[model samples]
Target: MSFLVMDDGEYSFIWETLCDLQLIFHPKYSREGKIDHKELLGLNIKKVSVMLDRNLLSSLLKLTRDGYLKDEQEMRIIALLMTWMIMNNYPASAGLALKEYATKINDLIEPKRELREFNNIFDYYPSMMWLRLAEGAIDSIPVCPLPTEPFITEIKYNEDDDHLLMHIAEMLHVVYLCRRRELSPVEKMLDFLIWNYKYLLICESTLVYTAMLFTSQSGIKAPKNSGSNDIGKILVGCRNQAWDLNYLSNWSSFHYYEKTMDEIFMFATNDILLKRIFINTYTSGGVGALIEAVFSKSDSQKIFEVVNFNQRNRIKPDFGADPKIYLHQLIEQEKHRVMETISDRGNFNYH
Candidate 1:
């Protein structure tokens, strides 16, 4: 029945540190070698376990009592804390006590929801909130740490993120893996874009963008031996599923959606591969009409102003091409390349 109060900054550090420690101690969660504790970590693990078990049940009860089942963030925090406790090896007694409460949270987060006809991607927020917590549960796994890499270092402390990209990426991995029949093909692509949006800001290599695009489209883990034929199909498959501007316009109204679109603009401005994806999604995916609308909408103009500047100066010099012409050219080249790859695959098999 004890309520603990801490400032956001302190709570964030504690949360991150616990997440890191969980991975550190649980080698099954992370590939990194476990660290031997030099001394007892300051926090009493036993006491915290008890608190999690107690508070989780109490929180759910309070939430229900207040008739605020729609307060997803609160639920998400409770779920994450419970997940963190489980990762840290909460006692059997605590788990048994909290089992019913945990089940309630799980039922609330279960991926299946009433799919509305007027589907905006942001409306999936409750599902996403649950999915992210689910990801935190799963992402307590092993990945090699990247150090001395400017990409990692540069983004680790970006004001926009609180050193949570690694965690976020892991969560996205969970989303990427499970988006199958749970989502439509278009929704899967949207999930992919959202997952890798951060990389569009930092990664300079077109290869990274290309790989991510294909992987997202395929809904399969990227294979090292994937040939040109395999890639061509993925590209074609993704492009064929054009976007709906209605969805994008609806998406734009959400708070963080702009950041994702901004990343798309940055990606398109920086690399031809991503530009093809962006332009295809824009023209075919229904964002083109929205962009036109955005231009006249003063409040929304900032979204594209920086992107337009870069497209005009940087992309134009590289291709000396107008956006419309450039988009068409890229589509044609991709078709030619896909055909060539298919032809090559056929000839190679015959030979």
Candidate 2:
């Protein structure tokens, strides 16, 4: 078979591979739209290390001093992963620094484990994903596969990317909540906080962390004026860091971050997914007395399923006398379907 030609399966795998690879590419990002703020990618290890989270730098510093680590291999692996995540999520001044760092760190560490020639995903995952994405693209090149390209109206990928920015902003709100609390047994709840430091970087290998008060007592501040618009900062971070669409970077002579940030702020404040059900539950009375309805003798609780963000998606069964039946009725099949559908509605691409 010619190397240039690809099968259907091969085409499918390419997109999946790109998704996987893109997960770890750390993009250089900032709130600024100046020349320096303009994004770049494929950074070198040194520059990545410079921009790394302080805690990550500290860990590496100690590792250098101690000259040993409990699981050197795992530690090195995490560092490599961060390099990619950084490239994918943030802007890089250099190209493919993460891959280079992984190789270098792997060689430098004890029990020197060279990346296997052709087996583990970690070894050649980035290259494989890139290849697949290329095969799937119309041009069969490694450039962005975003549809709705130039000389037209706004793009679908543009909206999707914007929506994702909002999602990340909401997720950051939870992270802030976690940071506010005192350090306890971690992951005791949904937020996963319990940190002593303001912004504690805990996860080994990866530098993902949270800050108690990175800005002020109120919380994260931003260039924007609105209170709800604080999430603008988070979106700003992602925009600056994300691949291709650098926030300040001049992509095709267009610096879109300023416009994108405003759009992101609107989405974050509106919270489309939350509002969809809120409108129905509070005003329409659609979420009527759940338990009472389910328990009612006439209600068919057996067939109904509850569709709640926190609740598991499953059928709730109850006999005529069962008290929980009414609650189950509250989550009727129709409600479940609507809620499920609306839950994912914010994912719509307005592009």
- Residue ranges of candidate 1 with Cα displaced over 4 Å: 1-14, 17-232, 236-321, 347-351
What is the lDDT of every predicted structure here?
A: 0.31, 0.27
Cα lDDT tens digits for candidate 2, 19-39: 333221222231111111123
- Per-residue lDDT over 75-121 for candidate 1, one digit per residue giving the tens place of the 0 to 100 score: 55544443333333332122221322323344321112111111121
Q: Which ten residues in a row have the lowest lDDT in candidate 1?
A: 262-271
Which segments of model 2 are wrong by more than 4 Å? Answer: 1-157, 160-166, 185-188, 192-235, 238-351
